[model samples]
Target chain A: MKTSEDKLNEALRSALKRKFDDFGDQPNPSSYDLIRARLKQPRNYKYLLLTIALIAFFVAGVMIDQHWITTKSDVLSTKTGIKSVMQKAANLDINQAATTKNQLEENDSVKQSVSEPRTIVSSTSTKISMSSVVPALSPATLPTEQTNIVDAPEILEQAEIAALPVQISSISALQPESFKTTGLNLPAITITEALKSEPAIHTNSQKISWLLNLASLKTYQILTVPKSGDRNFQNFKFPSTFALESLGYKVSIGAEKNGFQMMLHYSTFRQRYSYEIAGDEYVVQAVGQADYKIVRPGTIMNEDNKFELLGIGLSKEVQWGGSPPRRSPQRRSPVRRSPLRQYYASAGVQYSHTLNAGPDIGWINAGFGRQFAINRTVLLNVGPYAEFSPLRLSGKGDPFFYQPYRVGISLGMKLVRP
Target chain B: MKFFTSNKYKDLTQLVRACQKHDPAAQTVFYDRYKSKLTGVCLRYAKTRAEADDIFQEAFIRIFNHINDLKEPEAADSWVKVTVIRTAINYYHRTTKEQELHSSLDYTELQLDSGDYEKMMDQLNVEELLSMINELPDKYRTVINLHLIDGYTHVEIGEMLTMSVATARSQFMRGRNMLLKKLEKKGIVHHENF
Candidate 1:
């Protein structure tokens, strides 16, 4: 204790304590007022995360929807010959039809057909006037001509002009024997050409062309366990009634032609509930193997979780009413907007493998909805949908079983028709 | 200088209880009681007064937010002190500006002298001593303050600064010798034996 080293340590400690024990003085009251102000602010991160996710998904949905609509429409107009049909229809004049008819009359078979009772209805008609064309055709020479046309392969080149007036099956009925001698089996091509030549028929057949729908729904999830008495599935039981969950959103793009559509959609749901799990570690195999440990046995877990599901589906929709006629600039009266309405029923399979160790769900969902047009291209769609999980694949030997049944009403917007 | 004895909430436990309830009056009194001591701790770790104020503000905010988790109210003084020190260290870790300053310092051995560092300590005023400490690189100054002034062991310093225990000890020795050298340059301590 009396050593110089000991004395030096004591002296240094005392010096430091003397200088900084109380320091010079307390800060001014105004200086620490800032801390007090900061303490009053509150932070709730759960709501913040939910808000950010919702906004991000909405923006992404809109951007993707816009992109697909633009790209699909552009492809339809350019590569599909629909552009040629529209151009030919818009440029339809009596002089052009006469020139085309005169061109056809140059053939020896066409001159013979003109001498017969056979009538060549001009392609100038916007509608598919097959009824008018059929009545003027000679029924006697049709079968014999069809047999000749079937044998001659070179005649298919002129199938477009030949099939213009009649139904595809009656291709030979409109032609003379000389034209039918160069036979070709081109029924599919003949049908397509028949539709294309008549722009009005083509436009009407392709109605309700493409639609983009954004939906918001209040969901109810029913959790149930299978009756199969497997010891590995004993931890969960079925709920007899539905529990109302939070709202979710869905964005879908469907391409419809001739009242049938193929739809691809993405939807998100937030499930919030409490359930008891037998506390133990278990391995279950779903899309891949997974290891999970539910905290101690008999522990009740409260969850508020969000997951996404991607699905592809096919649907049949029946539509009535037509888009309103464009108002002429000469008519000053306000044009009343009448929107087309359609009803559709769809069935689809949805799968989600990413739930952070939760069971993967494979659901078969059936939905029906009605669309009311908001304008020429946009519509409001509202409907009810139900999803049932026939298969719940878990990691191997997983004790927890989840059979999710979801029923909800969705209100959405449909954008753009072809 | 103001002392804690002048505050209305003289008992540490009573002050902590009222602060936990988020009472404005109790919070103000609690801050007044610990401001000088904690700010002094922050100043030793920080390079400047503005930096010290920032650390102090952040530390107090954390203290109030987590004060509800404290089981013993009487220990609020030591708890608040620990929080401030940890906050200052974290602040430095976040900034990472000390790497440049630490790299510039020369750690070459100086002339060995068993000078009377205790006698040098007596001549220097608090401001002069703190000024000399602040002049040292952040790495060495922090180790010196933690080891000598606060009396934290080398192992504790290593853990707090996320460095090896041997590094902490070396830093403290270098920082101590630097302070003695500063005192000698000031003509306050003459090495008669050297």
Candidate 2:
């Protein structure tokens, strides 16, 4: 026999059991079923179609705009410059030396060769003329036979007619023959040497000018100026400029150790100058400078000498779609495309700040990324992304935001068909 | 055992498949088949029938929404059970404060006439044996409910509650001792030989 207490406890247990048993027999109609039913209904097809169409339209527009901007800017800078040089050549008389000097100076190489006599010569003359100069100067007086002078006289004569002054500087300052052997740096006599040579001594200044004019015409032939009809010019401009500006970038023009630079400026995001260096090849640099923002306040300016390579060989035209057709003979040539075509893999360590409904927080991430062309117009990139942020330090003492570090994979593709 | 061996199992599987396809009739069948089990889970956490019904409905809704994430169809019973438990815990946490503040006014009082009371008393004799479990604390109530009614072992209970098996066993023994003491005080059942 049980006491009242024991009976009460037993009764309570039985009640709990009965309650649970009731649950086993009850029906559960889930709210999720209604939602799913609505989603699965055929009547929603029109909305689904409209959503898909809108997303497709957005993606198409972005791709088209990216292609347009890239092509336009590339033509404006690279193609236009090359075309102008070619046009100036076609209109001028090859017999005139004065015009030839003007044409040669316009070439970026000639401008860069201001300090070197050999670079000056190579920038202005053809191979035949360059060969003629080698024999005229004695081995002892000339820089070593790094540049063969078989045709040195022809180049020297033309330079003399163009009123270039020839200076006999010891060859010690010149780089070795192997260094000068690149496609752009051919051998020839400098203007200074030509001015002092026999041709200038024998001819009257007016006669010399006539001969210079004729030589300019021939010089034009060897340098292929980009033609006006070049399809690249028509499409490669706006996209490249737009791409940089959309990211709040401003462009700066100048020279760096590697070559001429077009830098992208972002004052708020980063104090450093990000630029594309265009010379032997295109390189991307992130240059650190003293806080010139304080000195020039609100003005975007180039650093005098602080440019360093963050990465290299980034071609605006190729990225933006103004890239010349893949099947073109010039495209096939390693010399013409090699500089811009090389792939680069880079690693960067960054500190990023994120502000959310919680507290402002900071994180550190180290990433390694590789950019390579799938074809002339498409680029693919993949990288591992890992970020570390302290949960305690994030979101202004909010208990709900306690998720710490996030790790994931990032993959990207760019259509560069220009 | 019959459910696993009989044609009803095949029918249940077919109903589940139809439910996956969003067939209303199949969903109704699926609901009818499993509703009782889910309701039982809900009742464990809810203080009243209405609350339990709400929890049961909500648990089913969550099941339908997240069914795609379930990798194993054979584990559906366990999966729904776990989901219901989690949902009930969440509900408890949310409503405990409100329930605590209104404990007095919300409490139900019972009244009976002498003759009716005698009949009731006879019925209560058996019920009283189980009702004493209500005097136990919430944690002990859950442990006793799981162990005695649901037939879960201490190790399994420990895993569900994220506690060690030994801890679950110790808590169970402690709850049993408390119940024994309360029964002795009420002059209910006397403990003699084990």
The i-RMS of every model, in angstroms, reads 3.2, 7.3
Task: For residues A1-418, write the lDDT of model 2, one tens digit per residue.
Answer: 9765345445544544554444344332222232232232323567579546545544553465455445434433322233232233334333454454555556637422321112122323322121122334333444343323221223433332222112112121222332353434323545433223311111111111100000000000001112111111110111232232222211112112111122221111111122111122222334566321111112222311111112111111111122232222211111112112222222222222332222333433222345455554444545543334433332222111222333344344443323
For model 1 the local lDDT of residue A268 reads 75
Off by over 4 Å in 1: A1-11, A40-418, B1-10, B98-115, B188-194
Question: Which candidate should be chosen as best, given lDDT against the real structure?
Answer: 1
Q: Name the docking class for model 2.
A: incorrect
**Tens-digit lDDT string for candidate 1 (A393-414):** 4322333344555667766555
Q: Which candidate should be chosen as best, given TM-score against the real structure?
A: 1
Which pairs of residues have clashing backbones in candidate 1? A149-A183, A152-A182, A152-A183, A279-A296, A279-A297, A284-A395, A284-A396, A285-A395, A285-A396
Question: So what's the TM-score on candidate 1?
Answer: 0.36
TM (chain A) per model: 0.37, 0.23
Question: How many backbone clashes are present in model 1?
Answer: 9
Q: Global lDDT for candidate 1?
A: 0.55
